[model samples]
Target: SDVIEFPSSIGKVTFTHKAHQELLKDCQKCHASPAGGTIAGFDKDWAHKTCKGCHVEMKKGPVSCKECHKK
Candidate 1:
């Protein structure tokens, strides 16, 4: 239920964990852990690959950079 902020070369991406929890039924949908962890290892390439992949597969969520990233 915390705001997970990930700082990147472009900007900081603030992800609302609580909002996702309401939409998704499983924790592993985005998170690799039940307790969650730092986004230090989650880079742009990783996000584009993982996030966009899921979005394309499920036909939901945003795949655009500006949609998730702050200008």
Candidate 2:
């Protein structure tokens, strides 16, 4: 089947609808365009660099290796 965004990627990341809905009070909170102000949404300036950028700023980006992969 064709992937929604990146079809040629190694594999598709499955979504946990119920869990996400329960976890995230607002979809726009995490999924938004450049008009919402969050780097996840707006693209105005460095102020809003999105989750990845924000996390990186906090020394918590995925590149940290231990942020989410800690044992």
Our model 1 lands, by Cα RMSD against the true structure, at 2.6
lDDT tens digits, residue span 1-71, model 2: 12112121333333244454465456564556423332332332322254346457656434332332333
* lDDT of each candidate versus the true structure: 0.75, 0.39
> Whole-model lDDT for model 2 versus the true structure?
0.39
lDDT of 1 by residue, 1-71 (tens): 46778787787788777777777767776668766655446777877887778778889887777778795
| Model number with the top TM-score | 1
Superposed Cα deviation of residue 10, candidate 2 (Å): 0.6
Residue 21, candidate 2: alpha-carbon lDDT = 45
Q: Clash number for every model?
A: 0, 5
